[model samples]
Target: MKNLFFLGEIMSDISVEELAVILEEDDKWLTENYNKLIQQYPGQMVAINDGKVVAVGREVRDYCAARQKAGLVGPLLINVPHPDDLEPFLI
Candidate 1:
């Protein structure tokens, strides 16, 4: 299961149109990095910021806390399972 996190995009100041744009951009980032991420972090969680990977870990909370401490508010956090065991919500 891949989970996505957006940083500043979630701020209250953003309007509905802005939110949609942010989501669309985030989606593109994920799609563009999908294959590379799977090959690099098979069966692990990866943290990405601005389309660059920040870290890879087995535990979600631990990795997220690290990113937060490093001042990364919103990162694309994805769990890359086995290639054959693709998560149904990927699309």
Candidate 2:
């Protein structure tokens, strides 16, 4: 709570343990309040890359895939526009 702040659009950085504690207390509350908190803080990036565990490349992909398999709504990826599609993207 002390070191929490917003960095940019749809991003946040907070202590993982603090988040875990909040999640444990009331997952529903966390879900419901997520947007409000982000709005107040604005541009922020949450870092989940601390501690003993580390995920990279395939591992990250696999983790996301597993979540999707479990029926979780994962993050969306914007497709890179090729040279041919640049006009459309710009427009």
lDDT of each: 0.70, 0.34
TM-score for each candidate, following the candidate numbering: 0.65, 0.22
lDDT for 67 (candidate 2) = 42
| Candidate 2 lDDT tens digits, 1-91 | 3323212222235465855553454434434555453443233332122221111123334544544454432222111123443357565
| Model 2 ranges with Cα > 4 A deviation | 1-22, 45-91
Residue-pair clashes per candidate: 0, 10
Q: Write the per-residue lDDT of candidate 1 for residues 2-90, one digit (tens) a residue.
A: 26544454356657696666566767887887988887788888776666778778887777677867876556677776676776756
Residue 8 lDDT in candidate 2: 28
* Lowest summed lDDT window (length 10), candidate 2: 47-56
Question: Native-vs-model 1 lDDT?
Answer: 0.70
